[model samples]
Target: METEGVFQSLPALPLFLLMFSIIYLIAYFIVFRNWSPSIRPEASSCLISLSHGTPAVFLATRAILAGQNRGFAASNTVFQNLVLDYSIAYFLMDLLHYLMFFPSDLIFIGHHSATLFVFLTCRYVVSHGAFAILFLLILAELTSACQNAWTLANARKGDVEFAAKLYDFLSPPFYALYSIVRGFAGPYFVYEMLVFFMTGVADHVIPRWVWISWIGVVLMAISVSILWVSNLWLELYRERTKKLEKKMR
Candidate 1:
């Protein structure tokens, strides 16, 4: 009864989007008031991911499990739709941040744009595939907390000893987790999604091009993640080697 009431009174998607945007502003203007001007906006952006990632995983899981009909193109339940709205809101806010502060970062901005297109289509256009997309969201965000921590640590490591140490401590673990997810798990799931979508089982539920685009966007994102993490691994190896050389000298 309580849960039902909660769903009944859940705010509309636009209002939810507004709330997420407010959270981003609050992070930059209030919580990180003392942070460096350049770093603060990015930090606040990371905060929004932290605010979204883990919780979205759990919520997506709950929605997936509670849903009655299940398929790549099955109709979405109320809970599932709500979870999609939450993710859509997060991506939109984060996209705005990148556009405003880091417009030169085409990789992130493009990635966010592609992701939003996929999510928007799933939520509004086709009204299906919440299961697949939300599961992908879970995989994508599984390492977000560690990644964000490492990012924050990396951002300040130049000037702060503790931040440097934290960055060092976090690098290997975060890289391994991200690699496993992006390299192995992510590809596997996407492969499943592609095969499922290709079968035309969802022809009546989702248009062909839409699911194709979703798969394309997902594949591109995974490729980018692999490339991004590969660079981090190389950088980590060099950093550690330099540390060892300095200590030995």
Candidate 2:
């Protein structure tokens, strides 16, 4: 009863963060122990994300649909706030993963930090503008399961034959899905969000710098994703070409 009361009284976001941390620990120490020592943390990270990504897409979309009348900069609905809290918790866990296991990974660390800033501000500071943010979340995480599966497969490819085969099988489709989401649809939505905010609609509810900064971070994330996927495509092409040359010989 005492513990239940304390937990019930705890604030939502921090409590949610605690739950994510517990999940990460269990994934790392128990579920993924057979994975490569170096890969264990990341695999666990991916699992943690798998828990959030697709669910977030649905939750955010539901929130958007429920609150359509409020417009883009309107105050967050209950579901929208829950989605934001869920995402903030995931990013916090992921950031800690990078910080603990791979401190040298500055780009990811910085990316997570920027993302948390965006979510934190939305969830706490301004409290409005979740419409744009959650809609963007839906776009960004639509491919999360595929990407995470591909990532885990790629990680295990060197030692595990099935993993290598799975990686090969999944890469092209995963890349296609990711390219469409991050490259095209996401950018289009960002443009819409920017127009709304910049054209003076979001201006009244969201601060000038706040909305600009949010969109700016999202644009940067999209640019990096595009570049990353472009490289992956080139690498896949090179691999296929090498195989074709060998077959001809």
Best by TM-score: 1
Task: Kindly give the number of clashing pairs for every candidate.
Answer: 0, 0
Listed in order, each prediction's TM-score against the native is: 0.94, 0.93
Candidate 1, residues 1-249: lDDT per residue as tens digits? 587668758775777689878888899899988989989998999899999999998999898898877677788776888888899889988989989999999999999999999988888888888989899999999998998998899889999999999998988889999999999999998898888988888988899999988989989999988999999889878988998999999
* Candidate 2 CA-lDDT value: 0.88
Q: After superposition, how far is residue 120 of candidate 2 from its true place, in Å?
A: 1.0
Model 2 earns a TM-score of 0.93
lDDT of 2 by residue, 115-175 (tens): 9999989988998988888888998899999989999999989989999999999999999
What residue pairs clash in candidate 1, if any at all? none
For residue 65, model 2's alpha carbon misses the true position, in angstroms, by 1.4
Worst 10 residues of 2 by lDDT: 1-10
Best by lDDT: 1
The RMSD (Cα, Å) of candidate 1 is 1.7
At residue 109, candidate 1 shows an lDDT of 94
For model 1, the stretches where C-alpha displacement exceeds 4 angstroms are: 1-11
